[model samples]
Target: MKPIRIVCGTRESRQDFSTKTALGRSLLIHEAANPVDLMLFAENKQGLSSIYNRAIDEAKEDPAILVFVHDDVHLCDFSWSERLREAVETFDVIGLAGNTRRLAGQPAWAFVDDRFTWDEKRYLSGIVGHGSSFPCNVSNFGPVPQACKLLDGLFLAADSERLWEANVRFDEQFEFHFYDMDFCRSAELGGLSMGTWPLSVVHESGGAFGTPMWRESYRRYQAKYAEGGEPTPQETSVQKQTPVHQFHNPDLLKLMPTNAKRVVEIGCSSGALAREYKKLNPDVHYIGIEIDPSYAQLAREHCDRVLDMNIETVSAQLLAEDLAADCWVFGDVLEHLYDPWQLLQKIREASAPGSCVVACIPNAQHWSVQARLSVGDFRYEDSGLFDRTHIRWFTLVTMLELFTQAGLTVEAGVPRVFDEPQRERFLPAIHAMAAAAGRDPEMAVQDALPLQYVFRAVVS
Candidate 1:
């Protein structure tokens, strides 16, 4: 077996190596145990591609297996060198984690869309540990040692000869982001085989996702790989359809009364919230009301009862006689309703006195809406604040009025604000406008910040 040469870029210098860095410490420990076939190389004050390319070129003379890894990764498996050796026998290139398939506009290895939504677990492979310390919590994506189209660049290994022969090198144009993606695509185009391998590694950083710098890198990536082909009819139809209902609203779950016995959730999508909340209070009788029969069928596995009918059409007398719910949850459902005010009134009338109402509603006064409106771009999207299905909109003030008019006393409200960099100029402009309108500028800016509001209310 060829010797494994580990190549990584770090901000830390030689003198301050093992004490400050995760990779340095892991190397110090692993090298102590298995120093025979392992070699280490490091570069500081350079972009990742430059360092990796330099290492790849140098490996031509040495003719060793080159492993490119992030400086924040801690290699937990002592037998990793042997694993890499075995992996390269079958695959020319190997990674610790990867996706079996790649989408046209994939922003990341594990993600299928620009929304940063993860690809289905079925198409994913490999286990990864994450934390700031050594004993990390493992996230098992799926069974590994499988062939993959895209691999996570956090830890990648390949025989230097294979890369040199295939003429596959990290695209120097991509400094930090998309380099791995570019390299993987280039290798596949070059007819080099790729697969994921079982290796224990802990990555410290969660990544700078949604940051301005990351977004800029994504723009450059799209520009470089942008193709002229349009989506097929089937693909267009798939894209237009709403995503599967699997996400649980954390804010709604948090607002739920801890001791509530019976809970009725309006627009329960796949019983995700019920499934999650059931872990806390196992004996709670949960009922889900969903218009989609398929979603209701899925919800039946989690909830005590699943009502496959629209809330707007359900009679108040039937709701009061059957449900008698102590807690009612509406997670991002009110805005989609033709008349949420009437629905909430019916809920208040149907539920027990002092019964809790936990709801998550999108705020129309978010700066993104104002920013887009200024440019006459109020275009509806497949999802988000301007979802095409949304029939009504509400700001914080209007939302409060919504509950009050429904005879629900507002107990608490939590604003969900992302404080994105784009809001820097928009917020100040909003404050100025508020002042001109004789409203308190500080309070007005506060109202404009949150993209959504979560409220905990009770029947009065």
Candidate 2:
């Protein structure tokens, strides 16, 4: 059996390898257990594909299971080499974690679309550990040794002879991001079998996803692949699963005044928020304005009055009938309007002093949106920051401006954020961009963190 030849690249020099890096330290300890050939690129400035291609070319004659892995990963499994030896015999290309299907606009192996949406768990496979130590949190995607169309680039293994024979090589244009996806696509096209395997490895860094660099690489990937192809099976599946957006936001409810008796909600789909609020204030008269007659009918069960007409078409006199409402809630509704500024002015006319206007608006400055913008992917989704119905977008600054300009006194604004490990990794890139543009890194990070904002404004 051919021995496992490990190929990895690192920013750390050879002198600091064992002491400073996870891969270096792991190799030192594991080399004694299972001997293997190592090709380490220290202080590397070149792209990963360039580095891997060099290794592949160098090992053209020597038939061995070539493993291309990242420097931040620690080889934890004692029998990892033996596992790879067996895995290669079964599949032409092997990885630790991957998706069984691939979509047309997929930006990553695990994600189904450019929105960074994770493919369903059933279509996913493999489990990988994360963190600095051996006993780390495991992300169990699904069962391993399953057939996959795409594989994570963090740890990939293949026989050199097979790769050389198939004439499959990584595209050099992708310096960092999407290289794995591109490689898997190339391998699949070349008729090489790819699948995931059960391997124990702790990766320290969760990938930097929503960074400027990653987005630029994504554009290149899209240009190379999304040229001329019929809708894939994955794409068809995603299209069939159009997301439903009818959930109520608790943050918006919390922003409403407690002493208020009258409440009016805009675009109140099925009056979900009205139903929740009525539970708290039974005496509160809840009026819902819904364009859809079906939703208006459903909302009548929860709300005191349901207007089966568009708020845009409703006269100011009709709006003033519910005058002095304690709260006018627009939960994720303002952006859908053609003229939100005009509507705010009308709401101002209807409101009395101390009356609160609470709204939950999606932030256009969020890092995910920025990443999509960078890659030129403005494709609208059924629901999300990129909701197809959204006609306008706002940042925190502009949102405040909208309130203040419409004769409403801004009281407080709270951010709704969901922090992920990948999002945290994106901060360094944001900081670098901030420095280049002479902007405050702290403020830049602050602007990028929030997915949306819930603001409370009073008619002062």
Candidate 3:
């Protein structure tokens, strides 16, 4: 039998769960017949979406088992590696603690006293710790392992491949608080089984429920699954018949490779480009990623598949693993990213080595921008390069570096030209700034150029 490969995912904190805590103590001494990878997310204003999405992407790199645990959790049992290996054999989803019966609008622990479950035999188990730990002061829901409708978030283990097959994940919208229950519901609805297992562990803090934000999240959760008090696969799906919008995307479309067999577009708003491309070659496969449910529903008219997922929180690896495209397109999309360079890295890592990226990125080096900044007038605009929504500002040099740093080589650069009249409108300010900064007027004009950049990229 192949050795079990595991990836332990966590939102890391100051506490040393990896080396100093109760779980860390057991991890240090356990010898298991398996390989494990650790993926820790830095909790710098990030949420569970980043961690869970990242973990799913890691599974693409290596088809392994996924074990998500809290940084505050300390596993105190020995031979944990071996025990986990044995326990996960029969369950698609396994947890250290879970509730057998989940009530509508009730939290996971609503039936804790009677619905508690632990281990394969449906026996009850638990432990407590200081600073709000349980069992020492509290108690296990009961003393038997039982099948459960929902599992606690603290210690969740699942086969990565099985999860991919089931097509369930930690919903990005849930972010931090309600993700555990949300995931449990998603898994159950997808026909995956949930079970509990024996483990000696200590959680440092009890949950904080009933906060204002918590209540808000709770309302959204309830609303999301309002169909018969539970959403069905068909009801929740976003693909539906939609009227085509008249959106055009010629700049990025022209850069597409001549023989492109498959194309995937990130930030594809209702598949405008896909619609046009399908008219040319109906046989070519096209896919899109749109965050808006309504937009994604309309995208089905143009794309073979539309994934309704936010680019900021979804993993590029996870998307690439499924699309396997000949070319990946990003039209006026990079500037909107939280970390464009990091996204570039993931794209390269996940896609086939020779696959290319075609992009249309705004030029911060445009003379109009320079002319405005020269007068100390950097004001947000409704749209264009200075669009208020643009989170990233990249000049020519930095824009070129995007491809290089992502381990991609630029095949060609195509400038999205602006008419001379536009440049002339800001020409006077350009010279004025040049004189103030003691630079040559011609050099200033040349330095501040390019309305936008459209490039064709391939893996280096």
Candidate 4:
């Protein structure tokens, strides 16, 4: 048999590349049938996609497998090269950890909804390490070699010739985030299969989720691949989005019953939606809580009372002192909280009888997001569903689950539907994912198309 030509690329700061990790040690172990060509970008200035693409361009020899790795990851298993050689023969894509099953509206294979009792088998065996060389715990999905829909990007060995032939390209648009899954997804979409090679490796840091940069990166990924469903009215061009002062969803008003005499609004900036809502029914008393003092001051004209305070620090006393509301309006606030789940429970406990919590939350798993992810780009912006300020995210299922966990029951849900133009734009990507999920494309479209979940959550 011909020797496997393995080429490797790693991203590391010049200062931090001072020492080699387990990956370095494992690559040194040579097999007579396998020769390795390593490429370490001096200081990973260019993103992984660019670096990987650059390596592919610069390769003097035809490599069977192209390896991309993080400098921190330790390849403790000496048989890693042998494993890679074996895996590449059968599978086009290889990773250390992955999931066989992918739930709908999920951002990634690693991401799981806590509300839904999940199959903990998403782990396919890997390790996470602290400062020490020793691993803390073994993340196991099941004994490999396993087939999975997604793979952790910490260590990836991909079939070069196959991907080249398929014209599958690692999306350069994705910076650091969503590259691994995006690559694997692209390969799979091109009829490439992925499997886990039980190689011993450990990652240093658990990822930071929901940061502005991460959200931006995620947004870009979503924009490119996640399309379809009910696209939000907020999903529009940058020129239209700029110089915006306030945002209020009329859908929140629809969630409230006509009899609602008192309503409290969280994150109510200048009560933009309030003015629109009051125009329809001016009798309803509105209490506004806004983090921006300027906006809160402006809200006073439309509201019975307006308080300038961060919702993260909002207290029961604040809500109870002014008015016993008929319902609480969280128009688009839950995802921005440091602890939305806790706040939901607090809101549930503080409210009086017959009061409900009505919120308009962006679906993180919207067809648009899923579509972009399918292609691998997540770009964050100043405003819209993926506004940089949003610190949390939820799917329709997880949103309902949040209400349930907060001692509330879902009274009703009103989805913000996509216009025909938007629907036409996203349908193709949504159908593709639906087909991959083994569900009826039409039903999947119906189930996953809503841009936002506007719901009434009442105390159970």
* Candidate 4 segments exceeding 4 Å error: 1-247, 420-426, 438-441
In candidate 2, which residue pairs clash? none
Model 4 gets an lDDT of 0.66
Q: Write the per-residue lDDT of candidate 2 for residues 22-122, one digit (tens) a residue.
A: 88888888887878888889999999999999888987877778899998988888877888888988999999999876656677888756567788899
Q: For candidate 4, give the lDDT of residue 389.
A: 67
For every model in order, what is the number of clashing pairs?
A: 0, 0, 13, 25
lDDT of each: 0.80, 0.81, 0.67, 0.66
Candidate 2's C-alpha runs over 4 A off are 227-234, 238-460
Off by over 4 Å in 1: 36-43, 227-460
- Candidate 1 has an lDDT of 0.80
In terms of TM-score, which candidate is strongest?
A: 2
If ranked by TM-score, best first, what sequence of candidates would result?
Answer: 2, 1, 3, 4
Pairing residues by index, what is the TM-score of model 1? 0.50
Off by over 4 Å in 3: 1-245, 420-422, 428-444, 447-449
Candidate 2 positional error at 438, Å? 74
What is residue 413's positional error in candidate 2, in angstroms? 70
lDDT, ranked from best to worst: 2, 1, 3, 4
- Following a full C-alpha superposition, what root-mean-square deviation does model 4 have from the true structure? 23.6
lDDT score for candidate 3 against the true structure: 0.67
Better TM-score candidate (3, 4): 3
RMSD of 2: 24.3
Worst 10 residues of 1 by lDDT: 227-236
